[model samples]
Target chain A: MRHLLTTQGLPRDEAIAILDVAEDMAAVGEREVKKLPTLRGKTVINLFFEDSTRTRISFEAAAKRLSADVINFAAKGSSVSKGENLKDTAQTLAAMGADAVVVRHWASGAPKTLADSGWIDAGIVNAGDGTHEHPTQALLDAFTIRRRLHGSASRGRDLDGVSVTIVGDIVHSRVARSNVWLLTTLGAKVTLVAPATLLPVNLSGWPVDVSFDLDHAIAQGPDVIMMLRVQGERMAAAFFPNAREYSKQWGLNDERMRALPASSMVMHPGPMNRGLEISAAAADSPQSTVLDQVRNGVSVRMSVLYHLLSGAVER
Target chain B: MSVRTVLQHADITRALTRISHEILESNRGSDDLVILGIPTRGVTLANRISAIIESVDSAVIPAGALDVTMYRDDLAQNPTRPTRPTDIPHGGIDGKTVVLVDDVLYSGRTIRAALDALGDLGRPRAVRLAVLVDRGHREFPIRADFVGKNLPSSMEERINVRLEEIDGVDEVTIG
Candidate 1:
């Protein structure tokens, strides 16, 4: 509860509680005045060692909406570029009175180090770490799914019996990793569909079914089909034959889109490879929860910050 | 801790009935009336009073919940209070008679925070306070327009209000 470093071992009750609070935060967003004085006079620092504008801004919006003062500490131009370490950077921010720190780092377990090192007393929220976890992304995705399936009456409910098929870039996607742990914890059956090279080697530890064929996974009629963005920069070598060949086999093209049931949801953690991982037709379809995930991101981050900063006294 | 039942279930019903009559008499009718309750127990009491007013005058008054957790002055002192949803009735609070209701009014700080929260929503023609139990220990200059019971108690004592809608019982207790 003190820090939202990872969703890997987050308890069911605590996860449900965060989702329920996010529902309340979403209600506030629906009002004419979409602002709360919950964290007024408190400071939140967006400490990013990696460049993720979407996540940084989402946390900024969430903090500003909650009436907290925000400071965007991009590691690009700051003292971090001059070789200042995370310990010094965090302590410096803490000295400036940061109540919470939302961090996205290039190194895996960077957020956990910042939180447990105790160099600073601020609450740590992992925006994303290198191929490790993006807890808030998983939370927002869950929120979007729960809202779509159950609507306003989604409180106290888990994704029990729901089938989720995550496609593409399983080895390099923190989103896929986070979702696998969280969704399975919430009682959903997960299946990871990717090329053999694109997937991790040791799959026996994960609580999910692995598949090398996207068409067969689609034919099974999953309740949710999440398309992960293929990071071209991260793939130093060729993971697949070509973009066209990958699209023909594994991409959610017009043909694969038609194969999906109408009740099924299409999702993507954005900056999507429109033709590589998912087609424009599928991304723009009404079944796509992509925009819902973005909108819910703000509320989910608000709920996380609320629990970390505002809910501290109650604990 | 020793507990005392200050008001029984029947007592709460009668008190609400009397308060409903008082509100109806004061406003001359239910028109332009909106009863907004603070979250937890006050919202249930507001709905009950609204239903009684509907039965008596055949006028349906909108009842909603106003959560003041964000507007409290003591947030820094205790920063982890869970926030509830603030649902204003349809048509907004502008130019309406907003009667703020709560289970117990003790330090008046909650009322003060409620007033601040209401100010952000809209400008009401008139804002009144109503409470089921009014324990006198006012830290702020505020008073309830309609009170169910004026129970005088020490600051150490806690007033608990339980409604059948939420707690499966209706009674007021002081412990």
Candidate 2:
């Protein structure tokens, strides 16, 4: 509860409590006045070393909706761009009385450092730290899934017995890793699908079904099909043969989109390469909860900020 | 056969008048007041209090109904119909002093969940809990600062608070 750096070690009830609170936050979102006083008078700072429009704006919106004074500290134009160290910047934010720091950094474990360091007496929320974890995104995705499958009445409930297949770019995807840990914790069966290179090196110890064949994984009739954006930058000299081949073998195309079960949902942590990781048809398909996931991101983040700031002191 | 007329309707009305005066006196005349009623029966009670407060101060207080069903921790264990949406009259509650009105206070979980729900609506300047009956069986150490009646009840007996506006009855019944 203190710093949601990684969902890997989170207890099932703790993770579910976040989702449950996010469910209540979702109910608040549906109201005429979509802002809460839970984190009132609290100051939330978005410390972003990485360029992320969605995560930054989502945190900003969430903090603002909760009546928390939001300060967006983009490293692009700030002292961070001038090689100012993270400790100094964190200390400065601490001096500014930041109640919570939502951090997205290029280096993995940056949030862990911020949380562990005594430089700031603020709650640390890892928006995304390199390819390590994006807890809030996973929470929002879970919230979206819970709402779509279980309906509004099913808020505060876990995705128990649900099956999800996360396809593409598992090696460098914080979203995939976070989702695997969180969904599994919430009582869902997760299957990670990717090529040998795109797959993480040591996922055998992870509690999830790993598959190489996209068609075979699709045949399992998963409740959710999450397509990770194949980062061309993350691809080494040669991870996959090419984008075209990857699309043919792994990317969701119109044919595969049509073949998915009627109850199945399609999702993508976006800036999707239209025809590469997911076809336009599938990304914009009727079963796509991608847009809802983005919308729920605000509420999920609001819940996180509220819990970290207002709840009983997190250990 | 029935013992009636202990506290008459007029006496209850006068008590409400006195409670309204006390509320205004304590809250400093409702300058930045927003009354929110916990749902089912609390809304009616809130309406009555809002009317009384408005009558005395010539100020309109924004009142709303909050259904804490979705936010309740024991929702899964307790089988009940789904709660309706919260109806806040204003656009939102960015900087208002929200006085939450409830029929009875038992275990403070409802208010705790309501606080969670209120956090979603907007940040209030302050949230004050006001209840008609403060029945002390608090599992979560929650208490109402303002109370209409301090009725002590046991765990087995349930307090049913009915208001005339909605239930057409103005009495507190122990079941």
lDDT string for model 1 (B55-165, tens) is 999988999999998788876677466677788988999999999999999899999999988987889999988899999989988999999999999889888888888
What does candidate 1's lDDT look like per residue over A1-315, in tens digits?
689988899998888889988998888787778898878888999999888889999999999999999999999999999999989998999899988899999899999999989899888999999999999999999999999999978998999999999999999999999999999999999999999999998998899999889999999999999999988878999999899998998899999999999999999999888888899999999999988899999999999998888643532
Residue B126 accuracy (lDDT) in model 1: 95
Could you give the CAPRI-style class of model 1?
medium
Given the true complex, what DockQ would model 1 score? 0.53
Q: Can you list each candidate's DockQ?
A: 0.53, 0.10
lDDT of 2 by residue, A185-291 (tens): 89999998999988878877788988999988888889999999988776567887877899999999998887889889999878789999899989887899888
Instruction: Please list the C-alpha lDDT of all candidates, in the order they appear.
Output: 0.92, 0.81
Off by over 4 Å in 1: A312-315, B76-79
As a whole number from 0 to 100, the lDDT of residue B127 in candidate 1 is 96
- The stretch of ten residues in a row with the least summed lDDT in candidate 2 chain A is A306-315
